[model samples]
Target: MTRDTPHLWTEQKLDARYENLFGRAAGYLPENRAALDAWLDDFSRDVHERRARNAIVRHPSVADLARLIERDRIVRMYVSRMINEAHQRDCKNTVNDIPDLLDHLDCIVTSTPKYQGPTAFPMSALFTYLMMTTDGYAVFRDQGFNKALLGILREWCAHLDSKDSQEVLNQKNGWLSPAALADKKLNLQDFQINLQDPYGGFPSFNAFFHRELRKDKDVRPIDDPDDPRIIVSANDGKVVRIRRDIKRSDEFWAKGQRYSLYDMLDGSDLTDLFVGGDVFQSFLSGGDYHRWHAPVSGVVRSARVVEALMFTELEHTSGRDAGTESQVYGASVNTRGLVFIECPPPIGMVCVMPLGMTEISSVTLTVQPGDQVTKGQEMGYFSYGGSSMCLLFQKGAIEKFFPKDNTGDMEEGDPIKVNARIAQAVGDEA
Candidate 1:
């Protein structure tokens, strides 16, 4: 799709789509409602409730939201309203209330995401309905609240990493199902799967989510691997934006969601090297390949995962595609993995950043400092969540971008294949 074309369905369409999906589970059962009521009562009367209450009030944004809304409601209240709205819309199998929401979230943590088009962002969808509002948006921006949220998500990630999460690998309504493979356009032949083993020998949902790509030259061959000048895409995704003369710090929260180098790199010591450099950002859909690859042959200099907020999105752009448009903003604020590679001269240093969006916050890195990496070599992968990637180049490092495009222009939603030539180094003529 072109940049001008909206990537999300309208509210009516979104509602209809989710409604149909939920219909299969039957509307929230009576037992679920009873459990929800009981939990709510216990949650309200618990002596430890103040701890949960403080998780909101201590955060600046949540405090601001409470004042503006003229009430100091707890997190449970906010989540309950959010889930109730979805329940009221007749979206089946949804949480009956806040307690039910926790249980639903637990289920998601242990199971892999089902194949559903763009509407696969169920958590984001529920948050979108609530967070698009003035109060909800402010509350989500609170660091304390997000910290608590991240703790919960980390636990979920642990569960996803365990063997129990592999139960969803069945051919029926699972990731390997015919319907899912067709929907994702994933060919098992392109990957390294154990044909003899059930569930393709994957140990967990996370394993299946970041399945290894075959090393055959033709499968995802490096584009001119010997040519250091030919920079390739680090991951399989759609180009979101390409910006030059990036600032050290900018109005990242503004409408454009401009790149803030210092913030994006997590204040790394090497941030200054790319002050006026260029950044190539892209968005990875739930169904897209999740592995990271070297954009240029180089030696890994530094690599680390930076912890940050999990669910915050640009308030103005919430609800549509569940903050897919907020990628640039996410790069600055979300949890991400950063890998700095020092390539041959002229190409200099390149930084590959994988930013986690919403529920997809696990950034697993396979390489470490001092390791030599070749172009298209696997560096890491993101486990089961919406994700985006950014490649940062040093000032004047790149002579041109979108190597095949004569105009050297890229829109927000342009598809970019992994290992495909994306840019050219400044000194390389070929």
Candidate 2:
């Protein structure tokens, strides 16, 4: 990932950003310096109590941030103010305060996410509020800060991949529990789960997360798998948007969040091929299938992961879903895996880009360069977290997008099954 100096924020810009975030909220304003100071005193005492009882060991990034805040009075005030603001906004049913946020982070190290509405991504919920602050805008964009944060996420991923993480596969408050299954809309019979083993014999949470579907045509049948001209959905997700006549570069961070081919492809040699092409974007929720598949039958030309920011979102967006709503912006900046497959003529080369958001930044690719892939073949999967995918087609490559026109009874934000036909090539007769 390229690193740049953090942008300097003037007082006017800072206040404007604050107003953009909290201007409509009806409560005590977090901008009050004295109120923030008092809240920090109470928060400090809470942190001390948590440490005394739980013997908490902070994530390295958190510890480093604490040290940094301790040395700088202005930054410390900003941190305290942001935390106070987050506590007030997120006090409904989730992590209500800083200590609770820290406790949830500790819990995530040992346990998997239980299916809760907004709290399914507790870290995101907290950060969504914090990221609206001026300090968060600068700190999250800093190279060194993001590096430390990525390190912490890697460690968490390691734990989730270990066998010890499978302890959460039980019936009581576990991922396999009835409540969780119902909430996630997961059907064990639809997947290749072991009916004999109590926990389906899965070794880890990551294993269960990307569980393979049973090879039943009715479940996820590929639409004309033998036809190279037909493109299928690469993953199970909701169609977010589709854009045509894309530019090489655009103001991706702007309110409309236009697609920028060069930045999205990470300056790849093939980036120019899609300059005036089309992009199909979709989103995967915490409950959706995490594995990615081939959108066309072809030879894999390039497959590699690109390093980028994990938690940063468009600063102008609001709501708990700000990070997710910034998918177009994320396509240019978030940690993602790009796979280029050279198909037959007319269809040309198709680029499948899987983007990671917030805690779901671990993208593991299973296919390598020069490998021949059939349509619907598994290529990679996101370990654990909210994710989205993008399929790029060269100029004039797509004749029609099925989902865009509500073909096959699909509409925007509707659940799309993997391997389902999503689009047709320019030369296709159908």
Candidate 3:
């Protein structure tokens, strides 16, 4: 079960990619330093000091490792061929203005040095904070940028739809083969994969990324359907934060960055429904499953998509913004969708929000409004990169999360499966 040698993405290439990206983005900003300009000065200074003192180490802490255990397990369970499968289909006819950007995407899902080195949180934080400060979010929000990025993703998606992609995946020892690809990443025996098709029964990387598993009692069994109190995980990801007594406006960032309920809900009429609710947020890593499922068996009341910034991690490498939590704010500014589900009785209404980040910004909704959905039923998925999901409960609707203490408070979630019990209803008033 040893892994095959990987085609590594070196740090040199990553830095070069960042340099090019920053240069390109800088051109889009105005010479006038908006309000965020003054803020960046303080932010930059703080980050510089931290790096000078070597405050952040690249390696995971004991806590981080504990949380990453689930993340690593999930990665080992799946093949790395999902994104690589993009190479199999013909994209010659499609217009790809940034062909090189494809390699950047490849680098992400491929290899991470065995040792991730020091935490890049400060820099990550600075970039995310800056975007929020200077309306940098607005720059990435432009249609020109979004259309181009979407076009690139669409090209990759189209390739996944091609027979050629499947043929490559079916190959015995080819680079695109899932078996061989799996060898390059992690031992395949650690988990299960349906290899019914030559290409492992996956049409493309997209299909592979969102692959469903054969029914098993352990992987992610839905709780007793008759029990209306059970709530399942909306997706396979690390729980980032869990909070009770969420107010209409709340701080979501380091040093108290504030976001309003109206802004997060896109000014919907139902905003008041969650005024004093509880909020649960989790982030999907690059290696995690992208598909989302119903957390509760309920009738879909509404589903709406919102367009927002594409790149939320837009900062330099040297500063406090480089902190690992820097991209934390991206969940609020990034393009996302909101799903309103009306629980049969005592539970009332529950809201699930899926937000996109960086290259993984596309959110696809599979279920429509008014559809009756069973707990753990398919809801939607993120297309290409890491993203986050938020579950909003009315004031006291949640009694507790499954395994109670196994949440991702330290590093990530407990590698919970789709359809697995995540929370229980308290039958409280909406």
lDDT scores in order: 0.66, 0.69, 0.53
Off by over 4 Å in 1: 1-97, 115-122, 318-325, 403-412
**How do all the candidates rank in terms of lDDT, highest first?**
2, 1, 3
- For candidate 3, give the lDDT of residue 297: 79
Kindly indicate the candidate among 1 and 2 with the higher lDDT: 2
Candidate 3 segments exceeding 4 Å error: 1-144, 167-196, 216-218, 250-259, 314-327, 402-414, 427-430
Which residue pairs clash in candidate 1?
Answer: 360-385
TM-score of 2: 0.79
> Model 2: per-residue lDDT, tens digit, 288-343?
77898999989999999997887776765644334334677889998899999998
lDDT for model 1: 0.66
Q: In terms of TM-score, how similar is model 3 to the real structure?
A: 0.61
Highest lDDT against the true fold, candidate: 2
Q: Give TM-scores for every candidate, taking all chains together and pairing residue i with residue i.
A: 0.75, 0.79, 0.61
Measured with C-alpha atoms, the lDDT of residue 332 in candidate 1 is: 91
Write candidate 1's Cα lDDT for 135-254 as tens digits: 455557666567656665666677678888787776777767667656644656677776466677899878887888875637777788777789999988777677899999998887
Better of 1 and 3 by lDDT: 1
